[model samples]
Target: MSRISIIGTGNMARALGSRAVAGGNAVEVIGRDASKAEALARTIGGATAGTIGAAPAGDIVILAVPYAHAVPLVRQFGDALSGKVIVDITNPFNHDLTGLVTPEGGSAAQEIAKSAPAGAHVVKAFNTVFGHVLAACTPEDPRPLDVFIAGDDAGAKAHVSSFVESLTLRPLDVGDLTSARWLEGTSVLLMRAMSGKAVRSSSFSIGLTVRD
Candidate 1:
């Protein structure tokens, strides 16, 4: 089972933490507010709670915070995250949501990697799906949700792919870390599509089908 430490107390954090626990993987909920983290840990069940900035217990770290906070937080963790696989689940959308905050070709995952230690592996993932749908303990959809992954390290990407599979999700590796920018664009595009339809996570999801 994958040992995952999710950093945040927000919806994404709660969603992923609950899934990890339900999937029988070890989970740790770390938040800036220790009490909230503890509460979420209890709510998710089978998870340990921790204060932010502490040494993370899991080999895999999920940065579930907002895109704005992602870089600074990773810098704060610094070498503490050495040798760990970091899953960047952020979308660098601007305030108006008209465009991204990151440079044209650069993505949040690539920028995060700049601050990470040499040994740390940063993989971009889970930006294309809605948190509420992913939060469900048992998915009702006949087709499993698609999880697009991109990273420079083959081992790291494989590690994340395995974790996604463990949670009953499908992992599709588009390419190396550079493809994260495209994934971020896809996320924004879908968000815009959902804006007009008023569609919820259950009704709207990204799926992959292969033809025989």
Candidate 2:
């Protein structure tokens, strides 16, 4: 298992950190609020907590913050993130949930990738799954949630896939980083669906199931 460092102490961070610890991976939670990060780490168990800009000790660092804070956060990390696989798990959505917030011709992952330092591989993943589902489901769940991954680096994608599988989630490689645009779009649709009467409950999640 890989060491997972998540740059946020919010809901997504706690959910992912729980899975990482359950998978026997060393988890680190870093946030702007040191106390909040420490509290999250303690709640997740078997994880460490620290403030942002401290050198990430894990090979895989997850940007679990909001879309607005992601680029600048990566920029702030700068060279400290070099040689690390950075996972961007953000949905670039408008406030009303009617559409996406990404700039024209740009997705959140692509924008974050632009700000990433050299030697860092930016992978887009976990944007499609809601934090509620991530918090509820585990390796013991009958149906594992699907985590769609997109990245330019094959090795980095594989590394992320291995981690996802370790947590008993299915990893779907949807091709290069350009595919992230569609994944972000999917997130918007899923959000709208969840808010509408379609999903009915917050426990629902999206996944790909193939049958011969």
Candidate 3:
């Protein structure tokens, strides 16, 4: 188990925070609203609350914010995030849901990396699934959830994988950070699928199956 700091107090924060606490990891919820953060932490149980601009106490920092705010928020964190593993879980979708909002050939994670301070490693993950679905997952669940991770640093990827494993989920290492763009694209497809353009159902999470 690892110390986890989630930089948001919304649905994703509560879902992930609860899972982290259940996994025996130290969970901290950071938000612009101090009271909201405190309330979320209390609801999650066994977790701490923090203000947005303060230095995160955990080595692993999860950005549960929106894509539009991710880079600016990273810049705001500045040197305080140095040497921390920053996990980006945002889908940079266009307003109409027709496409991504990131610049051509760029992904939300890559843009976030550009704003990250020296020594901080940014990894793309947790974007392919919705918060409610993630919240439903547990170590005791019979079904498996596949968490695809993409990052430039091997140690950082391994560190994130450990946290994913703590929830009893599978971590699929797709490749280096360059693959983040595809992961973001994966989310776009998921959005459309969940919107009924591709799939007629809403009760599903992307899963990987391998057989020998």
- The reply for model 2, stretches above 4 Å from the true place, is none
Q: Compose the digit string of candidate 3's lDDT tens values, residues 1-212.
A: 89999999889889889988988899999998899999999999899998788899999999999988899999998999999999999999997778889999989999999999999999998888788888877678887688999999999999999999887788899999889999988887888787865776665789787789
Best-fitting candidate, scored by lDDT: 2
lDDT by residue (tens digit), candidate 1, 1-212: 89999999999898888888878899999998899999999999899997688779998999999999999999998888999999999999876679889987899999999999879999999999888868753655578889999999999999999999888888999999999999999888877877766565434678688899
Model 3 pairs whose backbones collide = none
- Number of backbone collisions per candidate, in order? 0, 0, 0
Per-candidate Cα RMSD to the true structure, in Å, reads: 1.6, 1.0, 1.1
Q: TM-score for candidate 2, please give it.
A: 0.97
Sorting all predicted structures by TM-score, with the top scorer first, yields: 2, 3, 1
lDDT of 1 at 85: 99
What TM-score goes with each of the models? Answer: 0.95, 0.97, 0.97
What order do candidates take by lDDT, descending? 2, 3, 1
